[model samples]
Target: MDDLPIIELPEPYRIDEAQLTDQAALPQLMEQRMDAALQQIEQKASLRTDRHIQIMRENMHKYVEDRFQEAIRGSDDNALALVRGELKIRRADHHDSIARSEARVVELVRGILNQYDSATRVRQE
Candidate 1:
């Protein structure tokens, strides 16, 4: 490190008369920069808020749709149950009617047999 040649240093920085007068405008420049920074921050915050609101709206819409679908499914289930019950009742009624018809046929056959037996006995006598 000591073998390196020495480098000449440049003169120190000095503010000239014109530059010193420009210092009077420093407060205005600072204020403008602060306002611009605040505006950018507010714009970013507004964008985030808008995105959050949109996400919430979408979730709410999906929730409502899901509930609607559930309600429709429940209604369909109830309707199916009602139809099944009605079919069961109708089947029972049909069975009862068939049983009554069979009983009547048996009674009619017995009555016919009785008439035939009585006629035969009278004819023999």
Candidate 2:
């Protein structure tokens, strides 16, 4: 903790194998360790996801352009209006879809953790 910059990590969270034998230390150890693990996972996921989102945005217009032109030809309405509307709506829809997909992952992680905790309690009893 001291080795790092001006940041002061909570002293209570320090992990020392020698402290594991003490029953009173378990809660503190678990809380600190779990928070650190979650933060690390979030950081890693953000880096990977940002790269993917950049690529998705770059390819989106090129990928959907042909379909948009076809749809514009088939419609009786204004071509300019159709183009503008589809671009706006599709971009928003794409963002929303990505959000929904990420939400499902969050839900699945919670569900898995809940099941594991329940099973652990049952086994302990």
Candidate 3:
């Protein structure tokens, strides 16, 4: 570090003798410097804020679309399962109806046969 060249630094600052005599000179200079420094800080903060807002805006549509797709995909299997369950119930009901119809036909045939037997006994007597 000692090998570094001896750099002649510039003078800090100087104001005209007439301006320095004014009581407001010191406060005005400080205010001007502070304003410049604050402007630089504000510019940097604005740039960062704008970038974040832009990124969020760009992704907003995609985010909403992804959520909708997930909801549909998540419910797809369940909807299919519900339809299948209803179909099974309908099929069972149809089979049960056919069985009841068959049983009624069998009962009617038995009653008719009994009536014929009674008629045959009367003819024989």
What is the Cα root-mean-square deviation between model 1 and the actual structure? 10.6
lDDT of 3 by residue, 3-118 (tens): 99987656655555766577567888889999999999999999999999999987997898999999898799789889899999999999999899999999999989999999
RMSD of 2: 45.9
Where is model 1 more than 4 Å wrong at Cα?
1-17, 109-125
Instruction: Return the top candidate by TM-score.
Output: 1
Clash pairs, model 3 backbone: none
lDDT per model, in order? 0.94, 0.88, 0.89
Every model: Cα RMSD to truth: 10.6, 45.9, 12.0
TM-score of candidate 3 against the unseen true structure: 0.48
Cα deviation of 117, candidate 1, in Å: 6.2
lDDT of 2: 0.88
What overall lDDT, based on C-alpha atoms, would model 1 receive against the true structure? 0.94
Q: How would you encode candidate 1's per-residue C-alpha lDDT over 33-61 as one tens digit per residue?
A: 99999999999999999999999999999
- Model 1, 77: alpha-carbon shift in Å? 1.3
Mark the regions of model 2 whose C-alpha exceeds 4 Å error after superposition. Answer: 1-84
Work out how many backbone clashes candidate 3 has: 0
